[model samples]
Target: MKTPWAVVVGEVADVKENSPDLPLKQQYYIPDEQEAEMAGSLGSPTDIADNGGYIVLRTAMAPEQMENLLRSTVHSIDPQLPLTQVQSMEHAISDSEAPRRFNTALITSFASIAVLLAILGIYSVIAFSVALRVQEMAIRMALGSQRSGIFRLVVLSGAKLALFGCGIGLAGAVAASRLLRSFLFGVSPFDPLVLTLATISLLLLALVASLLPASRAASVDLTEALRSE
Candidate 1:
């Protein structure tokens, strides 16, 4: 009867290095049944020796079981050799992915907080600026400035501030992105698409922040504003 198995082919040096001080009989393979049956009939221990390779019996075994078997086999063969850096393939794969996942999570969290703070800061600045400019806005209205014009002026001021900040931020990001190259996977730190999207988003947020203030400015009553001053 044929037993199913997985063939684990690695460099001889790697196998020896990973499985030092192990005996052959204690070692087992996750076998391919078809190949094992074809090869098993041709070899005794002496015949297997002339082939410069070893065969493993395919049986029901977990990864841990296979690992233990291989370690024991190596130890049986060479008791003096030390087994070092022994690990399951699954563990190696997980170790490889851990750093990438950590970096992604950290970047995502920082970006979220930065965006939230930017929106809040913009909103507060525009609100305060509009409040301070109420007297000036009333004067403009009294002097025949159109509501639309006042609105445009307020929005333009906010846009100018946004553009200035974004320009500086873009430069800083470009300079800082180089340090993050190791953390980036598929996307470049200096990606044009990312920069363009960020700029557009920040500008849009600035516009939104300024809108309420602009509307308030435009709706200011010349008589009431003048009387209050």
Candidate 2:
């Protein structure tokens, strides 16, 4: 038994009614044997069923090449027939999905840049705060505060600021969800998993950013800090 290839046979009426956006003037499918017979008779008035009226080309040809061949054959049969819209199914599907992929890539790039800037801002603020409190840290050390205690205090302070900022950010994200609805696919704007993961990631990043400053505070020398002040 010869292997049969499945090709889509779109009815002219159905295409016109259902897909007004499509530019295709007419489309049909016929079997390979009937292709030559229909070639001479194309553009002639003949009663044909919508489902199985057309010729089916050999499966060896790509959809694009097959579409081109069909167009050429039809145009040769009737030169006056205006070919306004002719496209392969592959091209149609690709065109339909291209915009979505491009949008996703753009949004992902912007999100990455925003996260990088946030991390840098957190690091700078924590570093500056630690620098300004150097003398205070030195005094605490001199008075008998443990190094671990100083480190914990600095980290906690940074954590409090990060938490506050994150809270505000979360509120803004919630409000902006409506505006982002059109861009989202396969995921909800307020997905709990996404929000939870984002929160945890941001908190971890903030902690990492504060680590260097916290370490410096813990290592402060009481004698030198007091002498400098």
Candidate 3:
């Protein structure tokens, strides 16, 4: 803003980042004394502000006690003067963070459930495939196919499916990045590190799930398998 006749100028402060939740805008700050002086010049000295102000106190006593003292002191001058929302800075900051914290918790809970379901679904599919292919695994053993080879074959099958899922999920996430941006704080919606870590976790779980059935297949008794088949 300019002076009364647009004749004076104000120095700009260094650019600084603001809270993510707050929208971008142009705002200026002036000392309380200068603001009060400006108000007095307007001929409404008692109009000090938009009838709103904050009083901060550093005290050993609890905030509730300090609030009572402040209210009584203000009332002694004018009983009509009001005091409200008398809270410490700590409380104010905590209240501001409450919504963000709750959102994070809720998203985390849903993500965890999704991961669990992915793990169980992959395990079930791989286990069933291994069970149906037991005779084939037995024949491979009978024909001198190495146990390590069979293990790799089974595990790779599950890994393939997990990899496919990761690819689709990543693509969908990138496409919806704009929609997801509001829910993120201090993080990009399409953060590569986050995607990489999630992909790796899914692959590791897939590997573990495949390992159990693969191990069972590798240890098959060829003679008993041939007779049963």
Task: Please give me the total number of clashing residue pairs in predicted model 1.
Answer: 18
Which sections of candidate 1 miss by over 4 Å?
1-95
TM-score of each: 0.59, 0.63, 0.77
The candidate 3 region of ten consecutive residues with least summed lDDT is 1-10
Best by lDDT: 3
Q: Give the Cα-based TM-score of candidate 1 against the true structure.
A: 0.59
**In model 1, how large is the Cα lDDT of residue 190?**
87
Expressed as tens digits, the lDDT of each residue in 15-85 for candidate 1 is 33222223334444433444445457554555334323434445567867876887798889988756555
Query: Candidate 2 — what's its lDDT?
Result: 0.76
Sequence-dependent TM-score of model 2: 0.63
Candidate 3 residues 1-229, lDDT tens each? 3332222358675443334466656766666666666555454655554677777789999888998888999999899988889899788877877888898899899989988899888888988998888889988877889999998899999899899988988999889898789877668987788888988998998888788888887887888878884
**Lowest-sum lDDT 10-residue window in model 2:** 43-52
Separate clash counts for every candidate: 18, 7, 0
Evaluation by TM-score, superior candidate among 1 and 3:
3
